[model samples]
Target: MKSRTYTLVIIALAAALTAGCASVAERDSRDPLESMNRAVFSFNEGVDKAVVKPLAKGYKTALPRLVQNGIRNVFSNLDDATEFANNLLQFKIQAASSDLMRVAVNSSFGFMGLFDIATEMRLQKHNEDFGQTLGRWGFANGPYLVLPIFGPSSFRDGLGLAVDSHFTDPVYQIKDVASRNDALGLQLIGQRADKMDALAALEEAALDKYEFTRDFYLDRRAGLVYDGRPPASE
Candidate 1:
């Protein structure tokens, strides 16, 4: 069943890419599915307003700073493995080594990542994902996409998310299914809570929220791919 879902997601991403290419010369050239994307974005916004925002607010209010930091640290530590793998794939030996060491330090001295001792030890963290891996391999960032619940993405990053979820996410590797799901949920909620302030500011400042979101996400992804200095063409 999981394999089937992965295959379907890949097929859909391919179709979206082809459609994006076919319409690149006209309209919202970089986002050929603007109409559909706007609709999805609206739905996502509604869901966020109805459920996510309230939950994030409550989570922020209920959790103490120390606990929240610990939660964030744990999730970040788990993500280090994914970063290590992507760094290796991108031929970033130094970054891969740093990520591996961070993971080891956090898992041992930090008590399964309840704290981030690696950062204090002067070990820098690197942001590496499958999307950046693809970019390093010369894959084009396809059209912008608005995923259900997930909000803004691009064809390339969307596929990268799928790959990470299905393969690299350590939360899913837990033997106890219920515990894994709980951990994943907590990670999502913690992230949402962490971003609440920034998101509120963005909502207040943006004239066209959709366009602002799309542009910001694209810019951020570009920086991530090129390690904070994207090329002029990108």
Candidate 2:
């Protein structure tokens, strides 16, 4: 099932790339698939409103702040492993060593990462991923894309996500299928809950939410690729 799903995603991305060439006047240079992306963005908003947002609200309401923090920490600890790998791929040895130590300290002294002892100990947390690594290796960012249920992404990041999900994500590596799925669901809900306030503010402030999201995603990704110092031309 996972293989089939991955295959479908690859096919969809390929199709999107090919179909995006249909020219539209006044389209943003970074998003030739504006029409398709907007439709997908609308669909994502509908799903979020009807299901994800409500669930996230309930999750926030039911969980104590400490519990939420702990859950977030645990997930962050798991992500450290991915960061470590990507840092190594990018030849960021110092950052990779920090990431490795973070996973070790958090997993052990932090009690399965329910506490972030590493951060308290002055070890900086890094967020590296396959996408940024690819960028460091000089891969171009293709058209902006809005994936169904996944929100903002681009061609390069979409491919990075696929690679991470299949290869690097610790949560996806759980041996038990049920446990892996539960972890995935919990992580999604936690992330959505965490972003509720920021997203609400965005919705209220932005005149064109879709454009704002796309630009923000692109700019932020570019910064990540260049270690917060994107080229002036970008």
Candidate 3:
């Protein structure tokens, strides 16, 4: 249910952002979404400082290889979804077929997690989404946006999230409310935990974290648009 709720919220956000696009240029620099993004960043930073770092140390301190394997599987699973969607959107029938094969094989053998054997079979993970594909074929991103609690996105991506939610794992379809919330929190925490190294690097290297995130987001979005093609230099 977490994914569904997230989807619904994203759809509502997409509608709001698209409908309010006309006024964004006129709005103050302190837009709510931007403010919320910054706030979440700061909050996440605090989380890292107070919680994530110590836990990472403890995890490494306790069960190093186990943590490593779990993280590997988690991201690998995500790649399957992305690769499959991208291939379908790009109209690459062969690639899409490979993606489905990977999905099916992994879902059963790997127990709903990606094993990354597909990449070894020469099929790469391609970035994609229904909205990005639509954008590439004709639809626009609609607007630059930073969705509340969801981070950076466009109206198109927000819609894509809504669509993508249906294919999410069983964790998203749990009927019990409290259990769903707990699962969602655990999932987000795990995702964030995996990003610790990246965050550390960004904190040290980037002159402007906001610019770094924005540029990175846009560049990543461009990858989705061009079906994994590298973006031209600005």
Candidate 4:
């Protein structure tokens, strides 16, 4: 069943990429599915407003700042394992080593990652994932896509997301279904709460929120792929 699901995802992503290329001449070159994307974006906005934003707000109100930070740190520490794997895949030995060290220090001295002792000890934190690994592997960022609930993505990154979620995400690897879901929910709420201020600023400032977000996401991904020094053409 899992193999079948993975096959279906690969097929769907390939079809989307092909369709995007075929329609590029009729729409924005980067966002060939602009109409469909806009609809999904609207749906995501509604869900965020009705469900996610309220939960995030309530979460922030209920938790002390220290507790919130601790939760964030714990998740961040777990994410270091993913980073380590991706960095190794990308052949970034230094980064992979640092990530491994961070995990070890934070998990032991920081009380199972409730605190970030690694950072204090001068070990830099790196944000790496299968998406960036695929990018580094020379996969083109296909047409821009707006995923329901997940928001902005691209064909390549979408596939990368599937791979990472299925194979590398520590939370997703939890053996207990209910516990996994609870952890996932907490992580989502915590992330949303952290981004509330930035989201509010974007809402207030952007003339076209969708375009702004899409452009920012694509640009940021490109920068990440190129290690903050994208080629002039990008």
Indicate whether candidate 3 or candidate 4 has the larger TM-score.
Answer: 4
- Number of the predicted model whose lDDT against the real structure is largest: 2
Query: For candidate 4, what is the lDDT?
Result: 0.85
TM-score of each: 0.90, 0.95, 0.70, 0.91
1-234 per-residue lDDT for model 3 (tens digits): 655556655655755555565454433332334544455456656766787577665655465666666656655665566657756766877877877887776666766653555556665555556667666676666545655445667667776665655553345556788886776665655666667778779879948787578668877777767757844631
What's the TM for model 4? 0.91
Could you tell which candidate, 2 or 4, scores higher by TM-score? Answer: 2
Model 1 regions more than 4 Å off: 1-27
Candidate-wise lDDT, in order: 0.83, 0.87, 0.62, 0.85
**Ordered list by lDDT, greatest first:** 2, 4, 1, 3
* CA shift of 47, model 4, Å: 0.9
Q: Score residue 99 of candidate 2 by CA lDDT.
A: 95
Instruction: Locate the minimum summed-lDDT window of 10 residues in model 1.
Output: 1-10
- Total clashing residue pairs per candidate? 0, 0, 1, 0
TM-score of 1: 0.90
Deviation in Å, model 3, residue 209 alpha carbon: 1.4
